[model samples]
Target: MKPRFYDLSMPLSEKTAPFPLDTPFSRVETMRMEDGDACNVTVITMSVHVGTHVDAPYHYDEQGLRIDEVALERYIGKANVFTVYPREVDGIPIITADDVRELSISAERVLLHTETYPEYAAFHANFASIEPDAIDVLAERGVRLIGVDVPSVDKATSKTLPAHKRCREREILILENLRLEHVPDGDYELIALPLRIAGGDASPVRAVLRMYAETKDMT
Candidate 1:
């Protein structure tokens, strides 16, 4: 049987919610067929971290690798999807290390479906964020990349961004704002390659997952 693919990326548009104070997606038509132009042409402007995207290590560390410098292999490989419910401590939703420890992390890439930031046009400040200890646990489990269903790995009000820093320290890449609501929890082949932006701290990605079957041995 042919393998099936699931799109795990959020649609980028003017209505797509961006990180607080970050640039939202916008398009300006340079040429239009309706306006007596030969063809339609547009200029897009948005933050690299907008919508579904990957955060290169340089996003946090000054000496870290840029988006173009990161290996493509890190973004494409076997990945495990784990659904984690939100738990609040002191009125803040967080994905604790204990939550990560309960997961069967058999792959180098892990996508956590928190269902916190479910609406693309609405920004939720209380979206679940992965704790720094959770990052440590994932790193110890040989996880090379972490993907989430929220705009960021750290809390919205976090200034220091401990989770992001820990990921950088562990050399783990990050994919944020993934659309995992329709994707069931299981193993899949992930292909979420970031754009090769020179000296970019981060880059948008068109993330997708291919259904993995054990009989076919699709990795």
Candidate 2:
């Protein structure tokens, strides 16, 4: 049977809202056929952390590997999607270690559906984020990668970014800003390759998931 594919990436455009103080996506038309140019050409500019993207260890650690240095295998493989609704703690929604422990982690790559930052064109600062203890739980379970539906793994107002730092220390790759609202909770093959940007701390990715009939019950 042919596998079904689901796009788990945010639609990147000029209106695609970026994180606070980060660069928004923009495009410039250098040549237009309507303007008598031979062909249409455009240039795009945006922060690597914009939209659906993967964060390299270097994003939080000075001695961490760059985006280009990380192995590609870490981004592509079988993954599990789980929906989690975190409760507010001190006016901030957080996914705690208990929340993670409740889920049956069957894959090396785990994508959490928080549905907090649902709108791609709207930047919501109060979106939910994973806690450092949750990161430790995933790492202890041998999870190599952690993906989320929000722009960050830590709270928007975080100064220390404990979750990001814990992930770096655990050597767990991170994929953030994923559009996982439509994806069901199950196992699927994930493909979210980052660009080979030299010395980059992060890179935008076209994340997707493949559903197979035979593997639906495997998890």
Worst 10 residues of 1 by lDDT: 210-219
Per-residue lDDT of model 2, residues 77-192, tens digit only = 88999999898998888999999999899889999998888788989888898888999999999999999999999999899999999998888999999998888898898999
| Candidate 1 structure quality by residue, lDDT tens digits, 52-167 | 99998989999999999999999988899999986998888899999999899999999999988889898889899999899999999999899999999999999999999999
Weakest 10 consecutive residues, lDDT, candidate 2? 210-219
**Candidate 2 structure, TM-score to reference:** 0.95
**Over the full model, what C-alpha lDDT does candidate 1 score relative to the true structure?**
0.92
Number of colliding residue pairs in model 2:
0
What is residue 78's positional error in candidate 1, in angstroms? 0.2
Runs in model 2 deviating more than 4 A are 1-3, 212-219
Give me the candidate number with maximum TM-score: 1
Q: Score each candidate by Cα lDDT.
A: 0.92, 0.91
